[model samples]
Target: MADATTIVPLNPDEEKFLRALGTVMALLPRVVDADMLEELPISSTEYTVLVHLSEVPHHQMRMSELANVCGLSLSGMTRVVNRLESQSLVTRQKCPEDGRAWLALLTNPGWKMLEQAWPTNLASVRRHIFSRLEGCDVAAAAEVLQRIAAP
Candidate 1:
């Protein structure tokens, strides 16, 4: 392996790609959150949490696992869940199998909220992302993005 002190420079195209990726990483969430907040009662992060919970069995997931999937810290996830809980959209219960852990469970209201928000979310995504990719090979781009996102 090269020494840690060694300097490596990106080519112009690589530099441009990295800059664009960084911008998107910073901007996409804010744009989507704005759209979601305008037309729905929940922010993008909360919607994302609900979406993940809805996909799992019993509409529940361990709190830590939920945090991981949501890309939030445990404390951040707790705050978000607390908000959802306050709205009657989700509930938290101590894990039966692991007493020290907790689980976030989606409520009936949460499902309804997701259902109500789907169309707005779809329109936002299509307008902000798909609409701009008219001539691009989307599947190939998705594969590249997936590879980059892989752990």
Candidate 2:
């Protein structure tokens, strides 16, 4: 039997794929940040927080839920949301079901900004990711990404 110290190695192609994936992922944030700065007032991370909130039903979600969706910690999300709320982009409402909990609500201004910014955001995404790949390859890439991100 093989010892725990022995492990199978990734083949050359597999290693290359991983290297490319890491590089692309590293650069992806810059792409988003540049585009967001040029087209919107918010940073890419903040835009993503807003985007995640926008996807929820009624354009509202709890702070914990938003943090999870945005891959952020609760405290980090709290800061972002507090900044956003101060900017009039979002509002915090006490959850009726749980007095201690709060829901982040997208304000009318936020909704309007999101609507105006969506097309530019989509364009940047398509330019950086989808446009470079073919149709079938794009679908395969999405599946591969999903598989990689899944637990």
Candidate 3:
């Protein structure tokens, strides 16, 4: 890694772009979280977890896998799972293939919750993002942002 002192400074346009990106990054989550919390019983993070599980084969995933994809620590994920469990939205079960491992399974109610929240989430995205961008603008933004977000 380069030392901070050796790092090159950004040009004015680059600095402005970086600032805009930073602001969006910081605020977008809050906006979505607020929208979800206002209209739904779940937070954005919980919706994210549900979405990932919904995409999986059995609406289930290992706790470690969920934690990784959600960018939460394992213990942090456990707490989130616990909250969902208490709400009857999810269930924790021992992994049949590995007794020591745990899986978070989305319940019927969890799927119902996702179904209920889908329209609000879509509308919020359209309002906050898609409606402001032309088709080509969205395509280009997706390409660049995907590259930046890749692990």
Which candidate has the top score in TM-score? 1
Which run of 10 residues does model 1 get worst, by summed lDDT? 1-10
Q: Native-vs-model 3 lDDT? A: 0.91
TM-scores, all candidates, are 0.94, 0.87, 0.90
CA lDDT for candidate 2: 0.86
lDDT by residue (tens digit), candidate 1, 1-151 = 8886796888999999999999989998889899999987798899999999999999999999999999999999999999999999999999999999999999999999999988888888888889999999999999999999899
Task: List lDDT for all candidates, in order.
Answer: 0.94, 0.86, 0.91
lDDT (tens digit, per residue) of candidate 3 on 23-47: 9888888888889989988988888
Point out the higher-scoring one by TM-score: 2 or 3.
Answer: 3
- Write the candidate numbers in order of decreasing lDDT: 1, 3, 2
RMSD of each: 1.4, 2.4, 1.7
**Runs off by more than 4 Å, candidate 3:** 3-6
Off by over 4 Å in 2: 1-4
